[model samples]
Target: MTRRHRAGALVLSGMALVLTACGSPAATDTTDAVKAAARQSGDTVYPAQVANCGRTVRVDKAPERIVSFFPSNTELLLRLGLKNRIAGQTWTDQSPPKPAYATDYRKVKVLAPGEIGREALLAARPDFILADGEYQFDGKKLPTIAELAKLGVPVYIDSAFCPKTTGTATLTATTTDLTALGTLLDVQPAARQATAETRERLSAVDKALTGRPATRAAMVQIVDKQLYALAGGLYSDVVRRAGGRNVLDDTVPKGSNFAPLSAEALATKNPDVLIYHYTGAADRAASEKWLRTHLAATAAVRGNRLIAVPAADFSELRAVDGTVTLAKSLHPDAF
Candidate 1:
């Protein structure tokens, strides 16, 4: 069957499975129903009070022309097939952006990274703004969400990537956000389909990894010769769901706390598989050189078992791409 067909079938199954998880409710309103579904499926839900970007805001309606200051949220927009609705996004997508989706991405305006000035975003006139708390708008001092709310733009933080809650029980996929986006944009069916398909695809990868010998994996992002190792965050969770062990899973607390490790430390750990997040000037050839020079002594480099995932995939929404990449890398022999 086609991927879409299989995805549709899987979504139906997941909905049926999730329904069984619904508990007796004191409240049966739409808000309660949405919350219950979100909790049952381990996903983020909307119309909920979320605090981030230094403000506590309640999402009232779906947004059109959503602006995202985070790369992962950019990928999420595309996944929901809301390319037409995206007004602007951060600059992270330019580096080795996925070729197949370039056409879709081009439709949206590309905003400068770390330059989410309220005026800049306000010029685009976005109905909603999605960003991680770490992103500083206008030299890191202006256009806070509460400030934007005053401008009549509802800002929603990407809670999935929030450093405070990431890698904790509170961490959930951005599916509920997708659903809310659907409602906001009047694309409810598309949102539901994307959510179902995304969940189903990840579930299949999880199923495929079942009973296999758990293998070790590591995530390293290279930029300008600096190798920043990510521990347990969105991408680490992707590694786990893909049925591989993350070498740095316990290296730090939750969020994007990158562990600084030298080549020697990497060699000592010597994971079975190496997954890289190369941002700039590091193509496959450059990655090979870096691996050979820094970790040639390790089993991963020696066996040529290294995979380079795009930076966009490091974010929560795009982490699905990372999961698929890891799954294929781990099971390449099957091919």
Candidate 2:
């Protein structure tokens, strides 16, 4: 299961130091002038407020000490050039910062390898927290947003993971979060540039696939020996944008993105392309072997259309990258 889904089930249980030194009067005056100019230019204003996951979060200034609860959220901050501000981060054994972020990722401290408890989080002394979803603040093993507010810490949950969000809005949700983070972090310019680039790449894929028939695809993963197909959320969105139709999209129930799949159902659906995601090469090989052995009769296996995608791509800022990668695989001539 995806981290989001896992965390949802566990709901019952769960910056850079800006160095400031006393400076000369002239230096202080210059700093004040710069602040005033920034305000006049409509840059990020202090005490910026936004409603996040039903909580009114207010940031008095760009966060200096940040605790990111998930690798995906950490990657978003890295993209925004806020790496130095990240004081700590947490990730599961299966999830790590993407290779592109390896160098910078090593600079930040890991608060824990897996789920962090309330005490560890408090020890980080974070002024702000970037969480994957509201599920992280379950008020059981983790601190609730209300509790954090009393301590002057504002929490920002990725809008894509907000409750009642639909798979169709995945692209919009990510771009929206990017814009909002840019505003809150005083990185509007960088955010705008990133957002534009993301849209441009997606647009290119759409243009290339225009008037073409979508390939029948299914994203499947083995969890505890059970086959689960992606029914909605970012994975489905990636398939849709890549000129492929998710055969299991309609099978997912409301508020969920995955559904159990049986061998009979797999053969019945008979997706033209079978997509599986993994974190490592070994895992990829294992999944591919499993598909070949168990579902050999399916058209996808017979045609050798099994594609392995990095699991991180489906959950992080790399969703666009996933879309492009899948597009190339599904419609090679178009790409």
Candidate 3:
């Protein structure tokens, strides 16, 4: 089965990916984060031992015709140049701008964006399913991991979403996951190469921003007239990695990254940058002009630092893209 994660840090009803940049609670320090990321990814040995949601699965050989659930998994697959192997996909928050593999998406089937469409998933006939976690394989609505295993389709959950708690989701975790996927698909060399490039890109951001003071950021979401601030998880991670700081200091659980806060509090804080995760369904339009009117006295309004990032990019499986996007915005000189 599948769970859509774009409803401002989606919290599902069943076993779900709680360890993501969305509903995750742990905010471990840098050292611990790398250790956890390394433990989960990096070595895709034969009989590749992969674990998820308290269970372990062995991948004896690379899988062909994979049915991926969610845009993170789907996009990661495309980055691996494995588009040909993806039989079908589901749940995208936003389509890629100028999608490089346009033909590849055209060839596959799509399930629902918010929930699993069991019939369509089964019809795709995948040899493997690149799932997010145990919560997604709830078995009742969609095929459980056990059910798929029984049918000879082993589910490969993203280990980044496996741990019950994690420090902050970082480029280290993203590259590790990316590397592991490449290894699982029998392409460690390519994974390593890509990871090296990722390292370089992150380093470039840091180097370009050495002397600049850290930018203070306020991540906000205005959906259905309600005001919420993006708390921890991927949003926090991106801010930290891009050489800025998340200024929405609150007692919100890392699980529910969205926290209801008064407009007065946001205006008082007056962070240097504003990131609004806009959900398209809102009746009233939200935009830069709207932000300026509401936060006229704030630094974000005065500095013109409002940045719009698609919701999916917040706690994304592939985190570097959002980091790079943010780095360019926070410190334009970094790019």
Candidate 4:
């Protein structure tokens, strides 16, 4: 299969659907119990919708009208074949458009947290809301989870990109989160298929790299004038699984998810492979020019082995589709 087509398949095959429900207190509990029972029939259990910052949330029903605050979460919903269900979204999210929803995106609805307040959200009347963790939610001055719950709307905060973490991450929460999504969406079989297929693809890549000397790699995301380095957390885990050695395994100078590094410092490390991540309006030419201009001293620049990866997949390191997207970008040679 072509890389893009394979990527599409990879995303579809490893789906996770997060379901949320809200209503009267007693009825909500009863519905939650029934849904939980239904989910138990599958291999995995439903994950508790924990509190973020200081808000507690418990989602029990399948949300009919959903609002996604983050781009990755929106992509996740789109990949689960749930585009029709997404009622509204935030513009800051940077995921690429899925063909399935391309024509309908404009019609779905757009609301900026920076401009519109919780009242705008309430007006949308979403049964469930997916937000960009507690920090952004608080920063945007939106209603707290407790307040949303009081209004009978359950909010799920994305902690996949939690800033407090350090070093290479395991992605345990990511895996469980996807399974939880499956149960919520009533797509348990599809979710299982998606997860298993991802494991298989990763295993195949690992087998291909077996016994070969590991290539030292550095994951760099470009943000304006500076380049942000991704540490060995969930993002790092995917690189390792695809058969690469993260050069920053030992560097803990700053926080883990993203670290600031000088161009000279990168040259000193002299990695065998360099991966560049870009978001809006970036292509191979842009990536190569950036490397030649700012990272000329690096070994990858000298050898011409630098690769520009789509910035969309650089943030959260969960979901089968993302793994597939990254695998194709990092290991095109293996395929």
* Candidate whose lDDT is highest: 2
For 190-280, candidate 1 gives per-residue lDDT tens digits of 6788778778887788677767876798888766677767777566667777777778766665455476767777778899888887655
- The predictions' CA RMSDs to the true structure, in order, are 9.9, 11.2, 15.2, 10.6
- The 0-to-1 C-alpha lDDT of every candidate, in the order given, reads 0.66, 0.79, 0.66, 0.61
Rank candidates, TM-score, best first. 2, 1, 3, 4
Every model's TM-score: 0.75, 0.84, 0.74, 0.73
Model 3 residue-pair collision total: 5
TM-score of 3: 0.74
Mind giving the per-residue lDDT tens digits that candidate 4 earns over 42-84? 5223333554424455656556788877566676676566788
Query: After TM-score superposition, what is the CA distance of residue 246 in candidate 2 from its true location, in Å?
Result: 0.3
Tell me which residue pairs clash in candidate 3. Answer: 15-135, 16-135, 21-234, 23-255, 28-167
After superposition, which runs of candidate 3 have C-alpha atoms over 4 Å from their true positions? 1-46, 132-135, 254-256, 278-297, 315-318
Whole-model lDDT for model 2 versus the true structure?
Answer: 0.79
Clashing pairs in 1: 62-184
Q: Where's the lowest-lDDT run of ten residues in candidate 3?
A: 1-10
lDDT of 2 by residue, 1-335 (tens): 63323433333221011122323222224344444555555467677887765667789888899898777777888998998899899864455567888789878899997789999999999999988777778899987888998898888887767776744447677788787888788788778888998999999999999999999998988766677888687768889889999998877786777788886788788999999977667777888888888899989999999998876676547777788889999999997
What would the per-residue lDDT of candidate 3 be over residues 28-112, giving only the tens digit for each residue? Answer: 4444444344334443435565544466665776777888776667766776778778887876534442265456665566766
Name the top TM-score candidate. Answer: 2
